[model samples]
Target chain A: MRRAIGLILLLVLAAFLVSGMLLVHPFGAPYPTDMDDYIIENAQNQTGSNSVVASVVFDYRGLDTLGEATILFTAVTGVLLLLRAQKRKEGGS
Target chain B: MLSKIVRTVANQLVLFILIFGLYVIAHGHLTPGGGFQGGAVVVSGVVMLLVAFSSQDLKKSVRERVLSIMESTGALIFAILGFAGLGTVFFYNFLVGSPIFGRIPPTGPNSGDFWTGGFIPLMNFAVGLKVIAGLSAVVLAIALFARGEEMEE
Candidate 1:
């Protein structure tokens, strides 16, 4: 029973991934492009960036980048702290 | 350390990898890659160097304190840029029309110019620094730990 369920789930995910790569738009063929269209059209002129993706990431979605940077910082600090403790124990003993 | 031939090859390739990574970060506003992607590329090169030279040799040079400072600097620059546009709003494109890194191109796709993106290039550089320092430190620590050694505290 578990094997069958796992196989079905894997097939579903694989289909979704392949379809995405093939650019197969879903049922509602063209969803509202209101925001997407505006950004695509104006991102270059408004942000003075050649790469639309860069503009969206660093300008349009700057807060998200800030959050990501914070996460990286925290994770690195955590790793260093944990490792240092291991070193300390070795020395202490 | 690996064979002498492998060590020589890694040493030769390291500079090119660093250059390519910097190019990706520098032209981020004009290219497909950004800081994280470029930093990952650079880190891969570093890993190759580590494998070729051994973790002990790397520990001698890749000081943890310096890496920590670099990571902090990158984060500081990112935060400062975010706050610089506080007049209009947080993370505003305040440099859109200024003389420095603010030259809007013709609408639609065109040949990319370096000095076009407002503060994005700066942000790219900041993030690139952060990723390079933070990830290298983590990887170096792990490599040392595995070999029963401690990184310089």
Candidate 2:
């Protein structure tokens, strides 16, 4: 019974994914291009960057970048702290 | 640590890799790549060196303290830049009209200039530095651990 239910769930997920893809806008031509259009129109003059994507990442959505940096820093710190602790234990014995 | 040929190739290739990474980071405002992507490229090169010369040899030069300092510097700069724009709003592109990196590109398609991008390029460089240092330190730690050794202090 459990295996049958799992199979049915997997099939349902696959059907949803396929149907969603089929109904979605084709490739790069997304339906909601309002945000894209706005950025492309003013990014160069406003941010003074030729690359719209960079302008978006570093200027328009800078808080997102800040959060990403924080995550990376936190991860690196955790790894270093754990590794250093192991090293200390190794040295003591 | 591998063959002599591998070591020699890595020695010659590392410089070019560094140059390419810088190019990506520097031209971030005008090109497809940016801080995170360029930093990943540079870290890949560092990993190449680590494999070619052994982590034990590489860690001697790549101090964890220095990396930690660099990461802190990048994060600090990012925060400061955000705060600087609080006169209008956060990340307000304050340098758009000032002398430094303030040249607006011609509308539509045109050749890109380096003396533009307001604070984006600077932010790119900062993030690139943070990523390169942070990731290299992590990789070095992992490599040393794999060999049942700890990174040098």
Candidate 3:
């Protein structure tokens, strides 16, 4: 059938897409710039704390932490609401 | 008897653990430990008490009302602290102020003091209480509700 031929063509296209990624990674080189060093130097100067990751999380990326906390709060609220018991009718009939 | 002695020891141990957990939460900013860990530890102590004594017996010591209030108030304090930091810097690290909000010495050391810091220790204690109460409520509710008899819903 024509559908079988179309499926084969799609499979070939998928194979090409996956194989293309293998060709790109080997030749890629990483370049280290002076800006990276300056960033480290300035961070040390401003925040007395030596913990770069903590500084980034609590200070520079604080908005991200706030958003994450809001997401957690929302999820907890949703779970609590779902778990709450529903009121039933009082009459025994 | 042996059971009586075991119960006495367990009670004392649970109390000590709870106090240590609170200390960890209180000194979180200065020390390596913080709220979540301390809260979990405190809840473990609560679990110990529940296990050593019956659930009904444990209920006599700590009420649901107190736990719920602790949770809600902790959340409120956390929100207030968030707003307090908005004046200076973003989440400006409010763990550097005095215990009584705006008191003498304009707070304490830069980053080393345990009692110092704006709202860090308070927030830690609040979060500790909140987590312990919330988790204990969840576990207690589940345990009670799963008893085969139909609950009021």
Candidate 4:
């Protein structure tokens, strides 16, 4: 009885997972565009260059990238701190 | 270890790829590929170098902290450019209009040259340096960590 219940639960979870994957949109579908479209369209006025991604990264989404860099810095600092003590332990070993 | 003939060919091919990567990085603003893509390609060459020379030989060449600092400094510079832009046009592009430490391109609005007095080119070099260093650091860390795992095994 217990084995049957477990198998039923597993089957239900597998069904849900397969259905979720199948519901994803395919390529070439007309998706709704976001604020990035308008930004790219007007990037010429702002940066005087044809590179839209550069305009977006350096000018428009600058603050977001700044925050991301800060996060990377913190993570690296943490790794260094963790490894520093490990080196000391290894030296004693 | 690769055979002698294969190793020689790989080494020559890697050098050529590295040169092409450098060209892509240097002419990023005026060309198609930018720093990150070029940096990754360069780092792949570095990876090939590691594969050719082995980890024991690679230790004397690459250091960890220096690469970390390079990556962090690149981020710092990009942030500084952001702040400078904010000061002028409140998040405007190329608003600072000053000599940005290094060579500022002598192109302007009327000059029809995309290489202008903005920090784009400088930022590309910084990002290229940062990404190359960062990726090599990762490869180094993984190599070391995996060595430990192999020892355990």
Model 3, B1-153: lDDT tens digits are 137777788889988898888887776645566666687788888777666676666656666567666666766666666677888865675544334422212222343433343444555666676677766665554544454222122
Candidate 3 residue runs with Cα over 4 Å from true position: A1-93, B1-5, B94-111, B148-153
What local lDDT score does residue A11 receive in model 1, on the 0 to 100 scale?
100
Local distance difference test values of all predictions, in order: 0.91, 0.90, 0.58, 0.63
Which runs of model 1 end up more than 4 angstroms from their true locations?
A1-30, A85-93
Query: Best candidate, DockQ-wise?
Result: 2
lDDT string for model 4 (A1-93, tens) is 999999999999999999997777765663666686777566555554445565565557756655655665566555544433243354552
Whole-model lDDT, model 2? 0.90
Cα deviation of A30 in candidate 4 (Å)?
Answer: 4.5
Query: Order the candidates by TM-score, highest first — what do you get?
Result: 2, 1, 4, 3
The deviation in Å at residue A9 for candidate 4 is: 8.1
Question: Lowest lDDT 10-mer window, candidate 1 chain B?
Answer: B144-153
lDDT of 3 at A9: 99
Clashes of each: 0, 0, 8, 0
* Chain B TM-score, candidates in order: 0.97, 0.96, 0.76, 0.73
By lDDT, highest first, what's the ranking? Answer: 1, 2, 4, 3
Q: Looking at the true structure's interface, with contacts defined as alpha carbon pairs within 8 Å between chains A and B, what fraction does model 2 recover? A: 0.83
Instruction: Find the candidate with the highest TM-score and give its number.
Output: 2
